[model samples]
Target: MGLTLQFIPYLEIEGLSSIGRIRKLLNAVKENKIVLLEGRLRKEEETELIKTTMEEINSEFKGIELAVIYPESQNMAFFRKAKQHFINMLLGDRQGLTIVGPASVVKEIKKDPNKIQLFTTDVKVKAKRPSKKKKNKG
Candidate 1:
């Protein structure tokens, strides 16, 4: 079966605080669910997220893997840049995504100038059993 994913901050909610979003994201991570965050977190928030995740991690539970992606700017207007900078400052983090989850399923997070890659692995195929000979009774 495939995993069920949920996106946060993708839609504009009337009343949603940064802390609220953080809580929702954290809860989903705790349940081992994949969460797609729209934007990046502030520096303080990033630190907090790491701290919290580290605390929950242990022998059985692997630590969370974070992949921060700074998307290419499409509209480089002065106004747009100013607005983005203001928002980033307010949140105390850069513009990107914060992914958190168990490392058993998530690994080899790669990033390029074009895009980000996650979950790279080698697949092993099992060999089939040989058919038995019809050495019937006499």
Candidate 2:
């Protein structure tokens, strides 16, 4: 006999709306599965997720937990670093695990090198396609 495991990846859908994605994400969580969310939820979506999770949270199902990754700069320019910081402050950074289940499903989600030493999933930001180029075409 052999143990079986499954991985379900939820990437951005071409025709699916934000609400649709949230609905699917919540549904998957309800099924007690680890979801590798492609992107971070919007501010409103995060709030809704927390609210919905809170309602169903119990002894068996803990709830949703977001594990973010913050990259450390190495010999970076002061102005560039400051600009990056300002941008992050305005539009929150979404660079890590958005686990929405019990600890049994996702025990430790880490991205920092220090945490990775203990063994964990190293999630990185998936590069976004340039949207500015589309405007230029118009």
Candidate number of the best TM-score = 1
> Model 1 clash pairs?
42-92, 42-93, 43-92, 43-93
lDDT, residue 33, model 2? 59
CA displacement after TM-score superposition, residue 125 of candidate 1 (Å): 8.6
Candidate 1 lowest-lDDT run of ten: 9-18
Error of 2 at 63 (Å): 2.0
lDDT of 1 by residue, 1-138 (tens): 355456666343214566665666777766766666776665676777778777877776676667777766666788887887787666544356656555655666777877877783344558798989989899
Q: Model 2 residue 118 lDDT? A: 20
